[model samples]
Target chain A: MALDYALLVLAAPASGHSSLTAVRFARALLARGHSLQRVFFLDNGTLTGLAAAVTPQDEHSPLQQWAQLAEEHQTELILCISSALKRGLLDSTEATRHERPGATVHPAFELGGLGLLVEAAQTADRLVTFG
Target chain B: MTAAARKSILVVSRHAHPGSSLPRSALDTALAAAAFDQPVALLFQGEGVLQLLSEQDSRAAGVRNLRKVLDSLPLYEIETLHVDAAAAAAFGLDRDALPAGAEWLDAAGIRALLARHDHVLGF
Candidate 1:
């Protein structure tokens, strides 16, 4: 049986090939019958949580891809609050707190503390980082 | 603890000094894990070993003084620090050149150590 595991995807959506590599790896894991406990986004990876980001017309949007994957797998997509705030990737709660005009965080991702990342690293059967 | 119940966390540091500030992220994560009394071990390889150098002037880099952050590890009960021997040599450093607390491990040692950890997170 495939081991149930967790993955920490740490690449920004627009950050060259590593971003696509992470997405492809996620799909491969599922196809091999593994499941992710959560997909933790940190540092520039938090940019993937932005709902307003627009990819090139000719390119696929990893943000949309991530949302679709999370929906299909029922995986928790967590973006680190500190990293997100620094990069201006704000969810509704954060947008309201910062008095921003509109919430920028995609609904598929949730804003959380880095502690969640720690928890995932400590408890998950496997934690792989991308970036 | 049973095979499934034991908690082991590996924190990987891959960034170098004065160029990127990933050590701060690694240290912060270590502190957070240590706060929970988790058995967290740090593995420094590649440029990440630069973080272990005893002498560094973050003032020149105008960074957040990650050296000070690393010095606080033991206070939080996080003491396991590992450095890849090859990585250290590649950076022109030996175990003695690193800070007093870090332990050196070879490539095979690194692989074995990683196998012991339940989860691994690279910063």
Candidate 2:
């Protein structure tokens, strides 16, 4: 039977190479005909969804890339709501909570809690983390 | 058995190398498990403590600093965060340097904690 996988991206953008590696791995998993149930962004990895920041010309922005992949593949992009909120990452709900002017969450992303993590582990055939 | 009674997971991360991808990956797994309502614990060992160090700037490299994600742990309902006391001291890290509410544990404590978990992932 084909395997269903969950890819966890945890490296901070500048701290390490996990984001890029994860993207590659996700692509590979898809190419192999495996199903990607979700991409869970945690800790520094959550920054992968912030599209507002200006990236340099030379650098590869994992956030933008992941967002595009998630959109194209219909992969679930989940940003830990607690982590996102504390870091000033507001979804529509959060923008209203702090009376922010607008939502910081991108289109391909959703704010979620820990329960999503559990579901990924229980439901997927393999839980692959890129840390 | 009920889903809630399933095995707990332990993730041990010891590196926070500049531009390394493991930290974010580890965090992703932890958050995903927590989001799924699975029991998960994150343990910081060795150089991994640097991940919690405050005021990191990834702008020079055109990246978002990851400290923001660490700040979001409680929001994900992933409250069982831990750091090795000896490792923290060896790295000259103090409580203030980490996110608020992170627990400090010694090697023995961490080992005991690991024993209780059903799975352990080291990065």
Candidate 3:
């Protein structure tokens, strides 16, 4: 039977290794013919979708890769807005609220709440998390 | 009802035996979810490999053997069990040393397996 998958990427780029691990897992999951319904970013994982950072030439940027994946796969990338805000990640609305210079939200991502997490759990055939 | 329609949870905990409150919390959550007839799968990762070691004595920690609790998982019908391959290797644990029926998975495999469950709770 076909399965709809919800993946939680919970590790930050600054964290040891979870971000890369999550990307590899997400790629492999799609390759194996599973359906990815949503990709919810929480805690440090939200950093994977930040749009303002400039990546050094030698480093692999998770944000760019995830953005491309979202566009190609049409996966809903949800950034936990509360967690992002607390961590200093601001969307256009938030950037306006705080009068920040640049918007942190990426085009491929949407600011959301815990309701997205609950919805992913309640709706997906499977919920997988990488942290 | 479809499995997707029912409430189910998969817990991935990678702490040692008699380790900390985290593993216990994961177990408690799994047990509670199972009690509600929600299918639960407990996947052990990292140091959580120690959890499957037989003859655990939690009395030193003023606790009961967690293995004992895990053994009763079948009674709750929470039978999907998984252990991380790298964790077992890190601890120098042989495959045969784990609980008889638990599936051993590599990192990538574990990732895919997790994607096959309804909900994932980790500690």
DockQ of 3: 0.15
- CA RMSD, predictions in order: 2.4, 8.0, 8.7
Candidate 3 residue pairs that clash: A126-B117, B14-B48, B15-B48
When summed lDDT is taken over every stretch of 10 residues in candidate 2 chain A, the lowest stretch is A8-17
Q: Candidate 1 DockQ category?
A: medium
lDDT of each: 0.80, 0.77, 0.76
Models ranked on lDDT: 1, 2, 3
- Report the candidate with higher lDDT, 1 versus 3: 1
Clashing pairs in 1: none
The alpha-carbon deviation from the true structure for residue A61 of candidate 1, after best TM-score superposition, in angstroms, is: 0.8
TM-score of 2: 0.61
CA-RMSD of model 2: 8.0
The number of clashing residue pairs in each candidate reads 0, 37, 3
Per-residue alpha-carbon lDDT of candidate 2 for residues A6-79, written as tens digits (9 for 90 to 100): 87666655557778888889988899998997987776667777758666789987778788788779999998
lDDT of 3 by residue, A110-129 (tens): 88876666566767777777
Candidate 2, residues B1-123, lDDT tens digits: the string is 376557677888887845666676578667777766678889999889888888788888775577788888889887767999888888888677788868899878988998887666666
Cα deviation of B45 in candidate 3 (Å)?
12
Per-model TM against the reference: 0.89, 0.61, 0.57
Question: What is the per-residue lDDT of model 1 for residues B31-123, given as tens digits with 9 covering 90 to 100?
Answer: 777776677889999989888877778787667666677777778776767889898988888566665578889989999998997777788
Ranking by TM-score: 1, 2, 3
Model 3 chain B, poorest ten-residue lDDT window? B17-26
Instruction: Supply DockQ values for each candidate.
Output: 0.51, 0.21, 0.15
